[model samples]
Structure formats: structure tokens, C-alpha cells
Target: MATRAVWRYRAIFAMLCAAIVFFALLPFGAGEGGVPGPDLIVCLMAAWILRRPDYVPVWLLLIVLILADVLLMRPLGLWTLILILMSEYLRRRVDHTEALPFWSEAGLVAACITAAYLVDHLALVLLLAETPPVLGQGLHALATIVFYPATAVFSQVIGVRRLAPGELDSLGTRA
Candidate 1:
């Protein structure tokens, strides 16, 4: 029974990661202007991390973020590192943050996203790569922060509920 539950959870995690990558690669209409893409992938990742960290193990999160970096053609391991750290931070705080008001959670996400972007920007500057305009990065961060609530709702609808303390065994528990 535990083995079956573990497989189910792994399958769901894989599907969600694949969905994020697939949707990110899908082209929008030509009329769509601006930053070129929404950070929906990050939003979903953050949602899953905050809501159910056990389902999103550190190794799996690393694999997904690295895959995203390769797919999105950004600097290798840049976002992987940033998001892994962010997810770890959120995972540690999930117990407390889950009890806070929605807006407070949003604020937390916003701060993290902003920090990630800033780090990316600084990395680009240090590397002397031609970076996108700051305004566009700002807009992208805003979109990501704004999209968190929707992603959280979608995650919940898909049955990824926040696990209470001592609820690990409700599914196959993870270390």
C-alpha cells in the first residue's frame, strides 16, 4: 500500500513538472508582446513547494529546475540554484506561512521572486551578457507574483492540499 501511494505521488509530481515545461514552450499569438513569457512555471513550482513540500523533494525540484534552465536556454544552473534555494526556504516555512493570510503569502512570494530576479540580473551583469531591460524583468516578476494565487487554486483543485503536522503518513511519507 505504501509503495503504491509513493508511486502515485511521484507520477503526479512528474506530470506537474512536465506540464510546466510544456506550457512554457508553447508559443503564444504573434500579437503577444513584452517579456516573451510568463513565469507560470515558477509560480506553479512555488505553489507546490509551499503547499506540499514532501511531494516536491529536493532532488526532483533540482531536476525540474535544471530541465527548465536547459529548455528555456538561460544560463545553466542559474535559475536552478535560485529556485532550489527559494523552494527550500519556503519548504522550511510552510508550516507557519500556511496559517497566515493569503495576502501575506503573496507578499512572501513577491519578495522571493524579486530576489531571484535581482540575483539573475546581477549574474548577467557580472558575466557581461547582454541582459534584458530592467523594466521587463520587473514586469515579469509582477506577473509571477500576481499569478501565484491562481496557481495555488489550481494546485488545490488538483488535490495537492497542505499537509498538517504529523500528516506525513496520510500518503507514502518522504524523508
Candidate 2:
């Protein structure tokens, strides 16, 4: 039974990763004056990280973000590292504040998104790369923050529900 549960976790993670890759490949006009692609993928990833950290392992997250970097033509590993750090932070917070109200969770997501954009912008500056306008970055982060609640709802609807305490203990021991 434990083995089956692990497989189920792996399968779901794989499906999410594939979805991110597919989104990356879509012709979303990600260039100048084009649609700044929605950060739906990150929102989804964050939702899973918060709801079921074990289901979304760090290595798998790294792979997805790396693929996103390559496909989206961004600087390799910049967003990947930033997102992994953000997700891990959220995962730790989940342990303490799982009972917090939805508004609190949204507030945390907003802060994380803001931090991610700031770090990304800093990296671009340090590397002497041309950074987009501040307004654009702000809008992108705002969109990501706005979409997080919907993504969390979608994840719950799709059966990525949090493991019960007993189940978490069992999975932890097995893993």
C-alpha cells in the first residue's frame, strides 16, 4: 500500500511537470510587447508544495524549473533557484501555519512572489543583462499572486489533497 501511494505521488508530479513543459512550449508571445505569460505553472507548483510537500520533491521541482528555463528562453537556473527557495520556504511555513486563514496564505504567496521578482531583477542587474521595466515586473508578480488561490483550488479539485497526519507519518517513514 505504501509503495502504491509513492507511485501515485510520482505520477502526479510527472503530470504536473509535463504540464509546465507544455505551457513553456506554447506560443505565448513571451517577447517584447507580447503577453507576459501567466505564472500559472509556478502558482500550481506553489500550491502543491504547500499542500503536499512530499509529493513535490525538491529534485522534481528543480527539473521542472530547469525545463521551464530552457523552454522559456530565460537565463538558465535563475528562476529555478529562486522558485525552489521560495517553495521550500513555503513548505516550512506550512508546517507551522497550516491552520491559518486563506487570506493569510494569500498574503504569504504575495510576499513570496514579490521576493522572487526582486531577486530575479537583482540577478539580471548583477549579470549586466537588460532588465524589463519595473512596472512589467510588478504586474507579472501581481498576476502570479492573484492566480495562486485559483491554482490551489484547482489542485484540491484534482485530488492533490493534503495527507492526513497518519498518512504523512507513514509516508515519511517509508520515504
Candidate 3:
């Protein structure tokens, strides 16, 4: 029963990510003079991973992020690589961070995102690839950070939550 719940929530996370990517590809106003939206993918990933680390395993993230990269026309592997690393970083710290207040979680999310953005920018520059404008990327990161709380709330509403004490022990080890 517990394993079933894990798989079920994993499937839910996957489908939500697909919906976010699909909306992103709509092209209603692609590249027009408006603010770039928050990276909802990151928000969802961070929220779900922090709350329930087992549910957003790296393999699932790797596949979904790769698909998003292909569909969104981003430079192959750049964003995917960084986000996977960030996800691992967050996942590794779940035990240490489970009790942190919301702002701290937000701060960690912001910090991870900030680090990912900086590394992404530095890498693109080194590769001589066209990078998005700094101001725009900064705004995008800020928007992502701003939207994280809502994403966390959404995850909670959908029943993706911290593993209960019994559930954790049932897994036979820490996540």
C-alpha cells in the first residue's frame, strides 16, 4: 500500500510537470515584450522534493526535464544538467532541513535557483552561446522564488506531503 502511494504521487508529479511544459509551449506571445514567467518546473520540483523526497526521484526528473528542454527549444542539457544537480542538492538536505520555517525553505529554494542561474549564465558565456538578458533571467528567477510558496501549498493540497513517521520507518531507511 505504501509503495502504491509512492508510485501514485510520482505519477501525479509527472503529469503536473507535463501540463506546465505544455502551457509553456503554447506560443501565444512567445518572445514578445512582456515579462518571462516563473520557472514553474523548478518550483514544483523543489516543492515536491523538499516535502517528499522519494516522490521526485532523479530519474523521473531527468526524463521530464529532458523532454521540456527538447520541447521548449532550450540549449540541450544546460538547464537540465543544472536543475538535476540542484534537485540532488535539495534532496540530500531534506533530513537536515525538514523543520526549517517557510522563509528558510524559500531561501534555500532561492539560493539553489540563484546558483543555478549564475552557473547557467557563466556556462553559456564560456560556450559562446547566446544567453538570455541578465535582467530578464534575474526577473525570471525572482518570479520563480515568489511563486514557490504557492507551489508548496499546491503540493500539500494534492496530498504530496512529508513522509509520516510510520511511512519513513516502513521505507526501512531515511529518504
Candidate 4:
């Protein structure tokens, strides 16, 4: 049962990611309009991982991140590496963060996203890659941070909420 549930949510995560990427890539003709939009995939990935780390296997995440880089034309492994690191970071802290108040958890999300964005930007700058101005990237990070709570709520609505202490063995018995 635990394995079944994990696979089900894993599929959901993939479908949702595909839809978001498709929608974002749609030719709305806006073409990088005045401001950059929030990185919704990153927000959703972070929220889901925080809630249920086991649902998102590392190999699965790598596949998705690489797809994002190729489809979204990001700096290949650069953003992928950053996101993988962020995911692992959150995964490791899941127990501690789950116990905190919602705002505190959201703050941590913001910090992680912000740091990821900053690191990504710095790497691009050092490589002399063409990137949008810092202001634009900052806006993107801000928008992503702002949307985190909504994604966290969405995660819960989709049954990926943080496991209460009582849920132990509800997932599966410990060895």
C-alpha cells in the first residue's frame, strides 16, 4: 500500500509538472513580457518534497530537472544542480520543518528559493552567460516565494501533507 501510494503521487507530480511546463511554454506572444513570472515548478517541487520526500525519488527529480532545463532553455545542469541540492537540503530538514509553524516553514521555503536563485544567477554571471538583469531574476524569485504558501496548500489538498507523528506506520512500519 505504501509503495502504491508513492507511485501514484509520483505520477501526479510528473503530470502536474508537464502541464505547468506546457502552459508556461505556450505561445501567448507575451515573449518575456516586462516582468518574469514565478518559477512554479520549483515552488511545487519544493512544497511536495517538504511534505513527502519519499514521493520524489532523486532519479525522478533529475529527469524532471533536466527536462526543464532543455524545454525551458535554462543553463542545463546549472539550475538542475541547484534544485537537486535544494531538494536534498529540504528533504534532510523535513522532520524539523514539519514541526514549525506554517509561516516559519514558508520562510524557509523563501530562503531556499532565494538562495537557489542567487546561486544560479552568480553562476551564470561568472560563466558570462547572457541572463536577464538581477532585477528580473529577483522578481522571479520573489514571485516564487510569494506563491509557496499556495503550493503548500495545494500539496495538502492533493494529499501530500506532512506526516503527523501519528502517521508513522500509516505509511509503513519501521524496520
Candidate 5:
């Protein structure tokens, strides 16, 4: 039974990772009079989904980020690093907090997503001078903010539970 459960987790993890990559590739509109593309919600969802870092290994996260970079033709290692950083930040927040309500969690998710965008987009603009239209950036940010509730609803609807007892042995009760 333990073996089956382990395999089940592995399968689910793989599926979730694939969904992240696929969703990242989707041409979701950035709103009116904008690029009408580029979805950052996937990064937030990936971070939210992997609230348990153990379930989503660093290597696997790196691979998925790399795939996203290639699919989006973005600067290599940019999104990969952003995802890793956000995941680490979220994990640390989970460790420090004694209790977190739904709204707080949703807010953190939105903040992390916005942070990732600000860091990456600004860096890209400074380094490459790409300067994507201001309207597009505004639209994307708005879309991400709007996207948060849907992700929260999805997690709740899917009965997305957190780490099991023994799974957090390394981090102790705090985590």
C-alpha cells in the first residue's frame, strides 16, 4: 500500500508539472489593446501547487522553468530562477507562520506572482531593453491579480491538501 501511494504521488506530481508547463504556454489574453498573450499565472500556480517543496523537487522545478523559458522564448534561466526563488520564499513563509487563512494565502500567492514579474520584467527591460508596451504590462499585472481567486478556488475545489505528517519531519512542526 505504501508503494502504491508513493507511485500515486509521483504520478500526480508529474501531471501537475506538465499542467504548469502547458498552462504557461497558453496564449491567455493580457486584456484590451495589449499583446493578448503571455500568462504568468502558471508561475503562481506552480508555486501554490508546490507548497510542499518535497513533492516538487528543485531539479524538477528547474526543468519545468527551463521548458517554460524555451516555450516562451524568454531569456534562459530567468523564469527558472524566478520560480525557484518564489518557491523558496513561499516555503519559508509557510515555515514561519503559525496559521494562515485563505485570504492571506491568496494574497501571498498574488504578491509572489507580482514580485516574480517585477523582478524579471524589469531585469529584462534593463538588460535587453525590450520595453514591452506599458499597456501590456499593466494588463498582465491586472490579469494576474484577477487570476488569483480562480487559482484559490481551484485548489479548494480539488481538495488540495498540504504535506502529510511524516513528510515534514525534516522541517519539524513549524513547517
Candidate 6:
């Protein structure tokens, strides 16, 4: 019974992560401008951290983030570190009930992601030979900022599942 339930939820989580990667890869363009791709991990992570930690583990988070990096051709391991750090940070804060509202979670996720983007882009600018297009980069940041809260809203809708007590014992232990 335990194993079946575990596998069922694990499969669901995998599918969600896969969906995130798929959506990330899809060319969903915005009007005339570039379409804002769905940032699955950010939205999912925010909700999962607050409500479904038992289903989404650090390992899976790292894997999804790495996959996103590879799919986006970003600096390898950068997104993994950022997402994991944000998840763990939010996890600890949740214990204290720090993020009590949707906007609060959105704000936190946006700040962390923005910082990560800046740091990653700066490093690439300084260390890599290829120069990124400044205008496109700026627009991407603007789109991410504008769209982050909507992702959080969707996270609240889709990722808030209740876990039975002690059902999450293993998850807690791993954390």
C-alpha cells in the first residue's frame, strides 16, 4: 500500500516536472514580442514548498532545474542551485509561517530568481566569449517579473495537496 501510493505520487510529480520542461521548450510567444514561456519550476516550487513538500524532494527539484538548464542552454547547474536554494530557504521559512499570503511567496520567488538571473548573466558576460543581446535580455527579465505572480497563483491552484500525517515521515527525515 505504502509503495503504491509513493510511486503514484512520484509519477505525478515526474509528470509535472516533465510538463514544465516541455512548456519551457515550446515556443509560446507573446504578441509581436517573444512569448513568455511557462516557468514551471518556479510556479511549482513555490506552491510545492508551501503545501506539497512530501511529493517534491530536493533530488527531483535539482533534476528538474538541471533539465531546465539543459533545455534552455543556460549555465549548467546554475538553475539547479538557484531553485534548490530557493526551495530549501522557503521550506525553512514556511515552518515559521513566514509566507502567509500568495503575494508574499510570489515576491520571494521573484526576488530570488531575478538575483539568480543577474548573477548568471553577469558571469556569462565576464567569463564567456559570446555576448548576449542586451535588449532581449532586458525584455526577458521584464517578462519574468511580470509573469511571476501569475505562476504563483497557478501554483496555489494546482500544487496545494494535503499529505496525511506520518505519510510524510520519510520526506521529513530526508529533509
Over 22-97, each residue of candidate 2 has an lDDT whose tens digit, in order, gives 8667766566755465588688887877777777778888887798788878899989999999988988887655
**Residue 37, candidate 1: how far off, in angstroms?**
3.7
TM-score for all models, in order of appearance: 0.85, 0.86, 0.94, 0.92, 0.73, 0.71
CA-only RMSD, every prediction: 2.8, 2.6, 1.8, 2.3, 4.0, 3.8
Best by lDDT: 3
Alpha carbon deviation, residue 36, candidate 1 (Å): 4.1
Candidate 2 error regions (>4 Å): 28-35, 165-170, 173-175
TM-score of 5: 0.73
- Which scores better on TM-score, 2 or 4? 4
Best candidate, TM-score-wise? 3
Local accuracy by lDDT, each model: 0.78, 0.78, 0.88, 0.85, 0.61, 0.64
Instruction: Put down candidate 3 lDDT per residue, 1-175, tens digits, no spaces.
Output: 3488788888998999999999998867437557889999999999998888878878999999999999999999999999999999998888877778889988999999999999999999999999999988898888898999999999899987776654562255676
Candidate 4, residues 1-175: lDDT per residue as tens digits? 4577788999999999898889888977335656677888898999988888878878989998899889988778999999999999988888888668999989999999999999998898899999878888898899899999998899899899777675752356321
Alpha-carbon shift of residue 132 in model 2 (angstroms) = 2.3
Tens digits of per-residue lDDT for model 1 on 94-155? 87886798789888988999999999899899999989788878888888888889988998
Candidate scoring better on lDDT of 4 and 5: 4
Error of 2 at 48 (Å): 0.8
Q: Which residue segments of model 6 deviate by more than 4 Å?
A: 1-7, 27-38, 129-131, 159-175
Please list the residue runs of candidate 1 whose C-alpha ends up more than 4 Å from where it truly belongs after superposition: 1-3, 29-36, 169-175
Q: lDDT of model 1 at residue 127?
A: 91
